[model samples]
Target chain A: MKKVFAREEYCLGCKLCEVYCVTSHSRSKDVVKAHKSEEITPAVIIESGENLSFALQCRHCDDAPCVRACITGAMQKDPETGIVKYDENKCVGCWTCIMTCPYGAVKRDEYNRNIISKCDLCSETGEPACAANCPNNALVYKEQEEEGE
Target chain B: MSLSLKNPEFLIERNYDRCINCQVCERQCANDSHYYDEEMDKMLSKDENCVNCQRCVTLCPANALSIRQYPLEYRKNSNWTGEMINNIYKQAESGGVLLTGMGNPTPKKIYWDHILLNASQVTNPSIDPLREPMELKTFLGRKPGKLEFDENGNPFPLPPQLELDTPIMFSAMSFGSISINACRSLARAATASGIMYNTGEGGLHQDLYQYKENTIVQVASGRFGVHQEYLEAGAAIEIKIGQGAKPGIGGHLPGEKVGDEVSRTRMIPLGTDALSPAPHHDIYSIEDLRQLIYALKEATDYTKPVSVKISAVHNVAAIATGIATAGADIISIDGYRGGTGAAPTLIRDNVGIPIELALAAVDERLRREGLRDQVSLVIGGTIRNSADIVKAIALGADTVYIASAALIAMGCHMCQKCYTGKCNWGIATQQPDLVKRLNPEIGEERLKNLIRGWSLEIKEMLGGMGINAIESLRGNRLMLRGIDLNERELAVLGIKHAGE
Candidate 1:
């Protein structure tokens, strides 16, 4: 499975990743106004608590429960990359996938559109934008076999 | 306005009643602004020679003294504000970006203006740049000792020349820190100007490949975005030993700024920390530097020239000698006041020596060692105008590189906040929208215009000096005379004070 790993030690807390992620998903790509608008919500949020602050995003799983729990067929695994992708067109405004996923990867837009949004692995670009722009080399995109085998 | 005697020693005044004598002011002044004249039994001021860094005023324990213009003024011209007149002239000629190098070129008492250039009136005929063909072109690379010819009478082998159409070239700046747009603009400008733009320590972007002939890629300590292909993709390779700003410190591109494109170019994973080590791990001694230089030479099949760039430190003469001996084709010396995309404000303002002193010392050392012509010299940091360029050449530089000046031509305001990456001028920011605002076409044209303007002025100055060629001015120290300089300063510069 392709996973995003963070070397939390190297994170400088610049928050550029969060801005990029939000812009990539938002309709306008305007960072300052995106947070307040109900139509768009950032797919990834940086969790800040006590000495640690890190970006939280979907970890595309091998056997994903979000895909199985989607009653409206909104979530599905790509056969090629095993990446769980959320389709807004078929999402049917249900929160089943959001409540059922073990990793809480599913999130809704600010407008209560009921359409789920999650990390799509940036498969189109071959590398995650969030991980690409991190200055500290704190993030890496690698397959399990390549990383371990 | 009343005119006081412009003696260098009597330029300052100190109020002892207001003076706490805490010595904080003395400690902060890099130019020794405040000193106790033991024989005179009073504190003294060295105001006339001060560069006006203002460190002493800000750090003074008691608000005892203030340094201001010595209250001398010329008749004011109300018809045009200085900035307005300059902007009008800049816009009229190029319809391009108003590119300039060094600090603000506003109306200041530039030392060059006070020193006049002599012309040949009775002895030699003055050549006009417009009518007579003048060669403003400069080649910055090692010259071969002798030509080698094959059996067929064809020259067998010789080093390639960094054929710059003009003497001006873009100085080094990295890719990861500066936006790709800025790099692209520099590449396009360099190509158009028939000059070269250095890649700084940052690796080259794939998109810049089209302008490879005009690119001078740099290999800095961080080795970020460097690979074999990256090494071969430039007209010349520069090994960045030091930068004028923050000379001894390494660069840190905060992870936040390491976008995917930067990470990809740098060969590091995206979003990871990109740390440029302080010094090259592979290079230790001069011999080690040679190994790296030869290694690059081998990598590129000796097709490209290798330049070594270093900051002008106190021992720059010795360092430059070592670099020349290390088989570098060119030696670029950056002075202390050089500009940078991002460096600690403290380091940028405090470190390194001035180019004037460094250049003279290096030239003297190289000439003494019988290796003056072994390497080409390119000096930068703060080369403000054509006059400074001529002065630099006389001090032994073959050519000069400019960065901050170029950026200003491309609309950089010099807000001194390049590290934020939210540069309003789009020269230093990575934000896509801001980057696009620079418009590379205008940037390129502006740079071309700036160089063209400077080249004409340089030719005029050289012609006025009774020297028709730029090369004739190089290392001709007899042409310079230091004004208002002490004996030691004059000795170091290898020139006599005016009226000596």
Candidate 2:
């Protein structure tokens, strides 16, 4: 399956992933427009330690825990795409998925206040905005090869 | 005129002159702080929802966004302040314990700031790091007090050691709490930098086995993913008794993060709670701990040094003594202010002592008892900068473990929202989208840069003391002087008050 992998050694901790992520999700999809007026909550985040920095997002594991933990069935894993999907309408904001997620990747969608937000791999573009915009290719979207070297 | 029952902690302001109404804040804020009113042809903001992660502010291309603490006022009561009143209201409504993330935000006594280093005057000539051969190489293992020679009159081999180019090692932050990319970054950095990165109880990932030589695989109470092969793969083994953040508590990895890879590494069922029991079931007493330590030694054929990691709790000095006598080659003391993926608010904030005091006490006790040569001391729990590293060594630490600083180098903003599982910075989350945000390739370089910078700083500090090697500075308390410290504090620290 094609997935985004982090090359942490090259990350500069610029957090431009967050910027592009917000802009991609904005109404106009224009960087300037998003920055000037919108309060876009970035689905992707950058974590920088004193000596290391990298962007973090959803891993979309095959046996996703968020899907299993959602009390309202608001969270689901796409069998075809291997993505964890969230349904805002079905969500009761119980935050069970949030509590169960070990990665701290599912966020509360503050706009609705009752729905959770996560990365959907930017299905429309077939590439994550953060990865697409990464200057150093620290975040890359690619398929994994079969094990055994 | 009346105060609202609750108020937003932060205020969001937009510079209209700079704003082009791009609506970036609306798109970036998961908290829904910004919205565009198409009918009004204007942008609007709701201050109540801002978590102040600064995502909108940082990503703003126009540089139009600003967030600040909301200046809402309450009657000034010293004892029952606004924050206290809010906490009471929250508890009354939710009846749940308030949880926080990251390190202790409250200002406390940071001994590093109060203690100053002494420089050479005339008797000793100070050396410059740029011109002199200053050494920061550190070895973490038992050092023989007296050299034992074989029949050939040559000194016998010393105990196994984890040799490092610098006196620093990345602390144990498991794969479950942080992403694989974060772990890989640390591993790669450690390998390249010639130090070590710990694989906190979460076991070693299959991809990381290549960096095994630089890895310190931890065997915590849970014994998660511990196997014979796992034991043989690392340079050293660390038996984790407790963590600095929650000393008596066990680790809790939410079921949502227990995916296949994590499940495999941890040897737990997918979508199940990965709880590390508070105490190692087999180790209730010091003797039990010794048995486990030896068992590990036997398993690894004693090729690797065994380290026992414990939180710096009360009587740490005595506890450390027991550990050294129990046959641990290295003793790691994590102080109260250490970082964790998630910890109970009460224990994280209240339990455990500062690493500074614990290190000083343990070093003193061990030296006095003539057991100092039997084990190496590694201290951690917010060792911030190079100065703190120097200070820790002079206070008797063989080396220091750094987690928060390493996380910062990788791009963590210290939002302390790790429990939420929605870490915007990828360092601490496992969700595929978030985890991928941290590219190990880039993360490793940043880590290398940070360590290189700190190593230089350490060398400079050593030179300023007119010392050419790091060994000469270890436990050299005379080079340190205390300011605004009591006589008892100074005496315990084994340093004289300034101007004495």
Candidate 3:
């Protein structure tokens, strides 16, 4: 399955990915409206230092620990697409996946303390919002690494 | 010890309703103008710190920011404008010379706009550039006066030349003055576009060695990175006696900008100001210049063309003659309105002459003295576009160097805060984070695209004039006519007034 990838060298560290990620996940799907009204946290996290940065999301690992760690069946790896999908309804405000996930891709929703937020690759848009909105080609949704590497 | 009696130059207005407190503006501004207020639970701006680079405005996702010139009323007088009063306040506060970045921002006469190019009339047919082939290739070097063929109809050995597919080349902007990514952008673009990019006074970086075929290494007064391998690494060598921005003045790269890379490349100690003296100590006369030129030639084993770069000043024609007679293969004259990393405001605005007038005078003087073929004229100091390039060639320049335009291509917002080392667009800053803002890959693509667009326009203009080859327009003053120009101006430009 295609996954979102990040190249640290090209990352500008502007966090537009985070901004757009919140917007795409919001009901308005408008930058200004979503940012102003909605309190959805950005599923993608930007790890940045002095001159280096990379936008990170769920790896959707083959032996996904989030899938195994969930006490409730809210977090499940899609058998077809390989995305570690999150369901808000079934979540019991469990912090189990957030703890079990070694990559720290899972996070508590800022607006609501109970539920969790993570990358779903923006399934409706057919590509993740973080990769799509990156000003620089830092984040890219690709099937696999290029043929060379 | 003293309070500044100055007003904020710009006002940053943020729309509170649109602002989502994303803090992107706060993150992007290197000046620390934007900040998140914990007390207010919102984003706030410190307007005084803003240089009006628009990095925050451009990156503000919700379009919540806009900067405007602060409308501070200081009892406006025509003679003592706000600008003049502000300059006084700044000078009094700092007690130092006013330093500026980029080119002169004054409203001086632009000769390129005043002069007009000719198009083919009813008597001649203009070719369609899209349908027909056009030649823009240019060669910069000393000519053999006339071609000499051996008995077997083979030409004899020729002087070294820097062959370019276009008459446009990236002017010398040193690495210390601009980021290495900016340098890499020009280097990559020049290589891709089949043109040349100068290494300026700063030494060539190690990564740029791969593009040596398109490089013109420079030896300035400071001789900052001059060595055996450095000399041999270029397609040509340019001796930078003077720059157009701060003519008759030396260059100073502040210790703050001399990071490890710049320090190593320039062969200078870390954190020491790189000072290039006004005069080359040994070059006191034209003869002295000849010795240095020949010395560089000898050092390069006569394999590369040596160019002497000078500022276009009063009696520039006479100086060009001296430089040509001094055995330099190419003469590059930079006009006063040129860009620089940093220069005193007084020198930048008041010093050298315009390239149009200088190019015409020098070309006419060389032709009159029968020394025209001995050197090629490469001019810079504000060749803004394709029309400027065409007009420059018509006035006798073989090639035009573009620094400011190239910087603009690489996303320079022209904030003129380059000396502060906080260029938000990343063209002029050396700070690692800011430097990463301009990815050389993207920069190279943009620069190449700019050149590509300009080349097409140049060809179209050339075809409209019924000229196929760019060289055919060389010194063709009849192809140009001055509009709204007086007698002395027309005389200096070597062109007739409109309807003459």
Candidate 4:
């Protein structure tokens, strides 16, 4: 399973992951235009503590609570890739996924308050933009064997 | 003529391209928004039945479903808002009062954001928490009135204290309000973090007895399952006179939620209404409160400190003085924006004073009365981040209690739907299927991470202030300045303008 892991100790709290995420998900896929003109909301958020900061995103667990708690079945994990995905079309905007995501990874898409948005591992690029753009490698995307399998 | 009601809130759409005639949405929807059409071999939906919970969306295998808010707009009238009209219609239909949960969501001035912290620039050297020891350790209890030495030059005997490695504590979330898994997560996290978690009104579960050293069992008006053994199974005891969410009111756990497990935990009859009284009938006066405090001390043999929790009201300073004089070792003040399992919407949004003003007033009053040293102040309402904690300490709180933040860490979305007992996140539900959604292991890890993150941030803030210990920050309003506050607010907060 491919998952994103946060190494909080190494994080600089720069929030580059958030910036890259917005650009990657932008319609034009241009960083400057996405930031300057577009109203973009990044899927990843960076939280800073006393002397430390780190980026947090969806962990895409094998058994995700968001999927279970979602009353309308808007949140689902891919059977093949183990990627936790959001179907905006199926979303009813109840915010159950937002409540169920422990990491606070799922967010209300500002453009459409009715649909919850989250990290999709940047499926188009085959790798997460946040992990790729991380200056300190604080966020890493890696594939691992299933625990029981 | 009867007014025409608004249209259904949500619009459910199903794509036939990928759908293989599955009926999972029909089975998963608690609101019964979906149903299978046997004759057509297809799925149909009723928009009015859906509350947009998104359960079926997550369970769908074909990934061909979508739901959106109905794009129906009434004639725009700023004076008559949609919510106002909808609420009026709802009340007209049901003839019942609105009930809500969690903290207040209405936009209001958050004092923590207006206040700015001062940092050491040149003269005072900033201490690096990484290199030097930054003491977040705190002791919650009555402090000695004076420093006295024995004949052998030993310090005087100290009162009972709840020692913590950090000043942050996980606030109250009763077992009945939240699931056992949620409580277990908090218990394990408290033990691991060397802090404390309160068993708010709800009696402690027997399985959590092992974490008694880090637990704060409460004795609310309901006295749900408070017994001799329950009193002794905690580091301290909190007498909950009121909660911040719904001040001057009681909590009601519907009979439907009073299942066998909740019944056993609360020591109440199954299917009985577990209503906590608004006031402790015995505590009519300060003297009466004192009597209860002493009674609890005697029950625990003076081994545990006694805390009195009250909502922040207009006369909070005077109320705090009475509580302190009544011999409460710790006085916990909950602000207006505190969370609750359930509360009347009217009371939750429009009652009680803010914690910031209340904490400042109480601290100033206690100090002026020369009784500040006798008790520890633990404040809560909406303590959101580490900066807020630092701000609280500067405002004179010994430590801060956190409930909503901790719940968020455990997967609460602040949807204010807890009163419905349909909390999909599992933290505030009694339903077996829903409650199982919260895994204790994951909950604990998330809580630990949140606290650890906050601790690091707190230490860094301390370092910026050139302070090495949290004690130095307590009651030090000089370290804080109000940026946008007026003269009255600044005076009330006891802080100067940011530029001043």
Candidate 5:
């Protein structure tokens, strides 16, 4: 499957990926309206320093740890997409998956503490919003089949 | 002790309803124009700090930001305008010459707008570029007066030439003035487009040495990076006498911009100012210029063409003739509205002449002296579009150089704050944070797209003129007519009035 990857050298640390990701995951699917009305929490997190930055999201490992770490059976790895999918209703808000995530791609809902926030790579949108809206092309959505995995 | 007289030039407006206090604008602004007030729980702006580069406005997710010219006006006097008063106030405060970036912003007469191109009528049908094989390829170098043959009927080798896929080139913009990314972008674009890009006085960086075939290394008065390897690495060498932005003046690259790479490339001490003196101290006369040109020719073993670049001033026609006679293979003339990283505002605004007249005059003079074929004419300073390229060819130019347009292709908003060393667009700054904003891959792609688009437009125009090759359009003044120009202006441009 194609995945989202970040070329950190070109990242401008503008956090525009977060803005676009939040807008894509929002109810209204509008930039201004989603940023203004809804509580915005982007699935993609930008790890930034004084002069360097890169977007971080779920790597979707073949042997996903978040799926195994979920206590309430809320997290499950979809066999087809190799994605660690999250079910909000089945979660007990114990934050076990957040602690187990080595990449720290998991986040808790700010308003509702019952569920966890994670990345689905915007499956319905075909391409990740962060990669699509990147002004510098630092984030790209591509297939890593050439890696010989 | 606490008195000031200058006012802010721009006013920043933000829509509070749309702004969620995301702080993106605050973080993106290199000028620190926007800040979040903890006490008021609102975003505020320091409009005075804004140079109006539009980075914040473009990056604002909510589309809530807009910049407007500050409505500060004078008491209805044309003699002492607001800018004039503000300039006086700034000089009174600093006691230093006013410096600006970019080209002249005055309402100067643009000859390109006054001139109109020709199209084929009922007599000769215009060729459709889409269906026909139009030729835009051009070679810039001296053409031998006559072909010599040996006993075997094999002709002697022609002079070295710079083959261009289009009649446009990225003009000289040094690395110290712009970021390395910008340089790399232009270099990559030039290499991809089969054109050339000049390395303005700043020595060629090590990474760009791979593109030597598409490079035109320049040796200015400073001779910053002029060495054997550097001279031989380029396809051609250009002796830069003056620039259009500030003719007859020197250049200064501040100490802070001389980083390790720039220091290594320019052969200057780290954190030391790179100063280019006004004139080549050794070049006192045309004879002196000829000696230098010959020296360069000798250094390159006469393999690379040597070009002489000068500002379009009052006596440009005579000067160009002298340069051609000095054995220069090419003569590049820059008009008054050219670009610069930093120049005194007075010189940039009031120094040089328009290139249209200068080009016409130089072509006329060279032809009169029977030296036209001995050298190729390349004009620059402000080549805005494909139409400008077509018009320049019709005005007797082999090619046109474009710096500001190329910079714009790589994302230069032209805020005129390049000397500040804090360019947010990553085109004219050394700041790593800002410089990384310009990805060379993206820059290269945008520039190629620009060249491709312009080449298409050029072919369409050439097809409309009933010309299949760009060389046929050179010095074809019959295809151009003046719109609102007087007889003297038309005569200088060597073109007739519209009705005529």
Candidate 6:
């Protein structure tokens, strides 16, 4: 299992991770007015609660319920990286993942298009944009085998 | 009145009969004006996108191409005048400031043409570069007072150094101002050339880490993306005190241009204006400058040399002396006529002194004070050809940094509209669509070719002066003579007018 761990103590409140996440998902790289329009909604959220602030993103679980809850075969785990990914074409305006997830990782586009979006571990590049661009080095990706030993 | 001609298409015409196809036109054409069409089985011309640089026509092997105004007319402005009507239309299109790139291509007096080079006739014999081994290797960092060696016959206590296989170096241009591909091109070229390229105030990107040994990271006043790791990753750290394009004024990467990549690198929020403050808040005096200098040194563990770059201005001599004493390992002075991706027209047109005078004055002042050895000098701002490099070293500089020249090699038309963020050449655009146009592989090869060409010419120029090594020409004023210069100008340059 591959997971992302955040060091909240090192986070500088710069919100670059959220920006990179939003851009990585956006059709265009224009981040200035990315969230202003109704077409795209930010996949990652920067949440602050009682002196603790960190980015909230999808965690691609071992027994993922989002894949099971999807009535349409829109959500599935990739065989290569075991990453939970969403297929917008098969998404039939379902909110099952939004309600079933315990961590509230699923988010809808601003137009209320029932198709949900979340981080896919940036598996295509093997390095997440959020983790790569973090200036403070707060975010890290660790494999389960390496962590266990 | 007749209806204005709409959908007017402009195209270029080339005389292939006179075209030798020597690749000079192909090399200089930034827009791919002339290309050999494989399928068509002939050379094709696309002069419509030409920026009227005249480089292709000027350097053409057979003088085959000449850029002319399109015959298509919007209206018969026989009485109104084409230029006047064009100016009105320009004012209407963008009320915002007009920006451009490259050096001034206007028909101004180029000083190199007026100046003449000396030759060996009676007393000295001229060395042929074809026969003799000419050394053009230039070291940019501070040199030691004396070379140290150990008892075991090995070099010990090595002085701080940066070696350049050639004297040419890629000048400062932030990653945000240009594309990732453009920076990649420079990085690859610098690595291949055994020279250095500067990251102008932009934080180092992860992709450019492979070229870290050949990179010189710059720290300007804003300290936008500066961090501990960025500081330590460079061979040298350049403190940008001022830019020749817009002296005393700071730079502002507009919110629109601040994409996610630039925003992340700068450690600022996306879409917010990245303001580079004109002056460092902590540096109000020379003492404060010293403190920051030592602070950086301490942070880097004294491994990398620190260079302080300043625009040439009146009293630059005094400023240079102060910067040297402030513990800087190198001093880079930019003349007023330097090129910039985006600068206020008012600032670019006016401000500071020419490099020739500024370099001479600073060298004289430093030598008089016996502090010339304290720091190495690197001059820039309109160093066009290898002759300028030779003249600059003979005047006083140890090496020179070039940006516009390098860009020209990488297919920049010098259209001078870099501020608009729609650069056609992909050298000065932040937009992803435009940035993708430039291929780094081709761009790097072009930069390598330019440096190689300039290096050969510089070596030839040195050989013409009967100098075997570049060191022999450094501060050797006897080889240079000024023409059409008054006594005061001659005295300032510490050289005599022609026929003295």
- Give lDDT per model, in order: 0.73, 0.86, 0.91, 0.86, 0.92, 0.77
| DockQ per candidate | 0.01, 0.10, 0.68, 0.02, 0.79, 0.01
Off by over 4 Å in 3: A147-149
- Report the poorest 10 consecutive residues by lDDT, candidate 4 chain B: B20-29
Quote each prediction's TM-score.
0.61, 0.78, 0.97, 0.74, 0.98, 0.66
Please provide, for model 4 over B88-186, each residue's C-alpha lDDT reduced to its tens digit, 9 standing for 90 to 100: 887777789888899977678889999999999989999899999999999999999778999999987799998998889999989989989899999
Note the residue pairs that clash in candidate 5: none
What lDDT does candidate 1 reach at residue B306? 95
Q: Write the per-residue lDDT of candidate 4 for residues A28-57, one digit (tens) a residue.
A: 776556655677678887777564667778
Evaluated on CA atoms against the true complex, candidate 2 attains a DockQ of 0.10
Q: Kindly report which residue stretches of model 6 are placed more than 4 angstroms away from their true locations once superposed.
A: A1-149, B1-110, B147-156
List chain B TM-scores, each candidate: 0.77, 0.95, 0.98, 0.92, 0.99, 0.83
Each model's RMSD to truth, in Å? 18.4, 12.8, 1.6, 13.5, 1.3, 14.6
Q: Which residue runs does candidate 2 get wrong by more than 4 Å?
A: A1-149, B1-6, B21-37, B40-46
CAPRI-style quality class for the chain A–B interface of candidate 6: incorrect
Query: lDDT tens digits, residues A5-116, model 6?
Result: 6766544344667656665665655443343332555566667655355677788887789999989889998877788989989998768998988789888866767677
**Candidate 1 structure quality by residue, lDDT tens digits, B317-411:** 99999999999999999988788766754466556777788888998999899787778999998877778888888878899998888887787
DockQ: the better of candidates 2 and 3: 3
- Separately for all candidates shown, the number of backbone clashes (residues 3 or more apart, or on different chains) is 23, 97, 0, 24, 0, 4
Kindly report, for each predicted structure in the order presented, the TM-score of its chain A compared with the true chain A.
0.81, 0.89, 0.94, 0.89, 0.92, 0.84
Docking class of 3: medium
Compute the lDDT for candidate 4: 0.86
Better of 1 and 3 by TM-score: 3
Clashes of 5: 0
